[model samples]
Target chain A: MLKFDEGKVLKNMEGALKLRPQINEVIDDVFSRGFSNVCWLGIGGTYASAMQAVVHMKERTELETFYENAAVFLTTGNKRVTKDTFVVISSVTGSTEEVVQAVKKCKEIGAKVLGFIDKADTELASLVDYLISYPLNEQLKFFMVGDRFMYLAGEFAEYDEFYSEMDQHFAKGIVEVEKAADEFGKEFAKKHHEDAIHYFVGAGNQWGATYSYAMCYWEEQHWIKTKSIEAHEFFHGMFEIVERDTPVTIYVTEDTQRALSERVARFIPQICGNYTIIDAKDYDVPGISEKFRGTLSPFILHAVNNRIDVHVEQINRHPMEIRRYYRQLDY
Target chain B: MLKFDEGKVLKNMEGALKLRPQINEVIDDVFSRGFSNVCWLGIGGTYASAMQAVVHMKERTELETFYENAAVFLTTGNKRVTKDTFVVISSVTGSTEEVVQAVKKCKEIGAKVLGFIDKADTELASLVDYLISYPLNEQLKFFMVGDRFMYLAGEFAEYDEFYSEMDQHFAKGIVEVEKAADEFGKEFAKKHHEDAIHYFVGAGNQWGATYSYAMCYWEEQHWIKTKSIEAHEFFHGMFEIVERDTPVTIYVTEDTQRALSERVARFIPQICGNYTIIDAKDYDVPGISEKFRGTLSPFILHAVNNRIDVHVEQINRHPMEIRRYYRQLDY
Candidate 1:
């Protein structure tokens, strides 16, 4: 009962791209106002997007940065967070146990709290010190999963040049995502039939995608053994593992340092017991320059990933697996 | 030449364990001075130690930490240090391109610098704002090959209650390590041949050991493939890669946490194309822990891991491998 089909996500993504520059300006303004350290807090797709931003910021800035699990806030009673610290708490639905608790912690610690939410009235928006809003529309296949909304969070900042370019690209992104989703669905299902285990590899920020599509959806939801690894680091020795029982999927993006990305992709088939590549270019994304418009690519890619997650749930005859080997993880 | 003979390391290691409490106290003192963050600077074996220590600290403390390649100081011309940040600089020789340049950065940044050194008059000693001594007497190995020095460090932290116990158990430990090394030498060499591919696995602090011995030393020295993975985490999905083409080695402690350690060991042989297990308890690290003491296990485990590195290098047939890779890694 969603108003927009998966294809419509392509346009929302364009709008999201248009909003990114503004988001960056807002972030920079807050960053200059006096935060010395940055923390990204979220779950699932938003969590993944947060991770990507964390890694990118580390490479992009010399200052201190971290990705914190909301659980840390819930558990640590004596934790010290100061006003000099920049804490970003996000959730697409604007409701999650850990995130809610973390916002409370950030307030107590006197840190600036920035939030991104899909709904204006959501709890996350109500609680954060500075909140940014996005469309609340849900029930859409892609939106049902979180993260695409993160890409939509770009309007909160002052950086407009990049957003304008992304705005232009957003209109056509939906078809590409559907195409990517359909292709991925067929390929993933076909591979799932042959192996009980699956592995996902994303280097650097790709871990964001790897964690969501592989660990959360594929492995956690379907009872498949899914794993993620940094790309360049993989070849030094892990090549031996790929040719065995694990069939790995590689997430390739245009923004990945070109040489490193291609080098890792080329080596995948060598070590993977078997392998497949799912590529997203800037053009294929809601914008150009994989990173220029963070809003468009992550939301589009994650939505496609989400669509496949749904497809796998539908086509598979296997039992639904709810595994709790230990309490450290959740689906 | 080092003052240590074939058996002298065992003697000093025994001596060092007697000094463990003060050693343990001082190790924490390195970080107690209250900086906003820490940057570990070093090269080669010394840098290797810093790498292991930084990771251990990150896993232990809530504080932010990072590693600065000793070489980056050479051309970056960036030295903005402050009370908000500090450096823990290490040097076995006190003379390295990056280590020397780091001193200049420390001066430029106006941040306090702590030098961890084997010699009092090293270049690093003269420049450091605070100095920590990791001295080895003429009767001991100094910075030469063999891990007696690092092992003794482990003993430094838990010298009181564990000294006599370690003395009683050490001969057995040495014998076991020697036996494991000899057997490991023959089999591992045959499998790796001249390719220089190796894998190391450890859990908890042992993961630090794996990173140093298996990844840093093996790969840096030989331009080979060496990777370290968290033992328990590796099995969640990665074990399927162990095949005939690649081999793995693991480091374990006798009193390893029961919940995780045992399960990982049980599955080792199933996936390691080839594998070996060396318990820190029996790894023959003279000065390190004879038995798990009250302090964190990393202190003891890291020293034993250092010893394994020396032993592996001592047995390496490719003598020039280290020299060949040095240029690519010298910084």
Candidate 2:
């Protein structure tokens, strides 16, 4: 893998899985306290991550869960967010103004805030009632929180077995996924890195990954213009702009909405000759259960894309860390 | 105005407002019968329309309201939707496949279905329990149903007065808005109709309009490529792709999320040399109350965009009704 450090990646995943006991403890405490509902708040990429959790929660559990944009929540202030609400938040930088302010307000409203922060001394860590600090996978942390809550509530019975498997083999599985995808990622970047723009489509739990990758990684990190559309909405209006030479990517997952993206995949080749389909079913996670593929597809797909990001940076000659206006210039 | 029939628009608006009494009656009947929650279902454009309604419902009322994509609803049935749920839907052609299927399933589940159809006879019209047939403004009809429900629930105190004012002068006020926006619309289309692509940013209630206009009209109707970003998410990752010459348009409204879009509007001029700001505050709806502007900004902003759509059609030499894929071919 180009520009990839396997040791560091494995270490991060191991550290993330190590937080399982703490996550279980926090979720058990919250369940014992008896909250009204679950509210997950974030901005940008984290918001997209929360959306994935909300989709899974809606499908598998009867819990009333809301994934709200932190900035909008700050401005509009959800009425359902009260003293009995269990608010979950995450911030890697720990200095995102909107996240900090939202956490402050959530604390003021007497809601129990559980936050995953990267540093122990960050403002967000101080504001949250329960803080889990680690440079770990945010997606795994989110699902840990959600899975534990559902397990306690009797909505998810296989939670213990699932996490036990994840704690052992998930890091090694992610590394294998990246290695398997490196060749295709390099080819994709080499062929279409300089295209006018890119179009991405995905559905089910993978929609959030598609959205975040297009905006947060391609656009923000590499300054590549891209449009991400939900597979269900792809035929509605976006298909009209596709030509024979247009570059497009479609993600197919093993979720219930697999048919939705499969529909897009079937049609894209008819109109767009330059298209790629990234199917999660193609990758084999050594020790994970087949039934849990839908639940873990987003994380697997993201690791696959990380390979593409490395190749894109190397081939396009654009460093991933450059920014024009974000935090560099004031509005 | 170029290619615009003011008389037809005025008559359509007048006809839509005429459904006030019937909408009120249906809402009253549903309320008296007592439903559990309100669910608005649609696909694509209609889904975007339902989103605007949901934003208002969340802000003003305590009623449990959900705006769901019809396709997703059919694929993954909602646990909240039951016999006591009130499902509201609309289809201009009244034969959208996913919508018809969802409505049929809802009926089978014993939930009451209220539909707005433009024709008296269609598959969807037959599926719904309560049908309102007319060629009316979907946005107006949506709000009418929502306002009536809120008024009955005591969430909206001035509902009757607001509807009375709308009946008297809303159509005429809309005509004034179009007339007022004609020159700007013409100039905007003349300058940017040939641009490689367009980027739109909007927040709060105006976000749905921005999304629908960008994808539904620009891409589907005119074959123009465009990207629409929610204003709050603008700074996160999308901003990094914007250059000095990007053709960006920001929509500013009077809603609580006004500051969100205003931030984008203020920053665009600093980054992009060629940018446009469509502020709803500049438009005056003569008969509507000043305090109701935030609630009405989406309609006002949409009407303003309609003017631009007309000019874009004329200036770009592309007919708005032409479609390359949508309904023209089998995918």
Native contacts recovered, each model? 0.00, 0.67
- In terms of lDDT, the poorest run of 10 residues in model 1 chain A is A137-146
lDDT at B93, model 2? 88
Please write out the lDDT profile of model 2 over residues B1-331, one tens digit for every residue.
6766989989988988888888878889999999988998988888888888877776777677878888777765677788999999988888788888999889888999989999878878888888899895888888888888889989899887887888898899988898999898888988888888899999888887788889999999888899999999999999998889999999998988999999998888778898999999999989788888888788788878888889889877899989898887776
Please name the candidate that would achieve the greatest DockQ relative to the true structure: 2
Best by lDDT: 2
Sorted into a CAPRI-style docking class, model 1 comes out as incorrect
Clashing pairs in 2: none
Each candidate: chain B TM-score: 0.62, 0.97
CA deviation > 4 Å runs, candidate 1: A1-4, A7-32, A42-47, A72-80, A92-97, A117-126, A133-158, A270-273, A282-304, A318-331, B1-37, B40-64, B67-295, B299-331
Please report, as a value between 0 and 1, the fraction of native contacts recovered by candidate 1. Answer: 0.00
**Candidate no. 2 TM-score:** 0.98
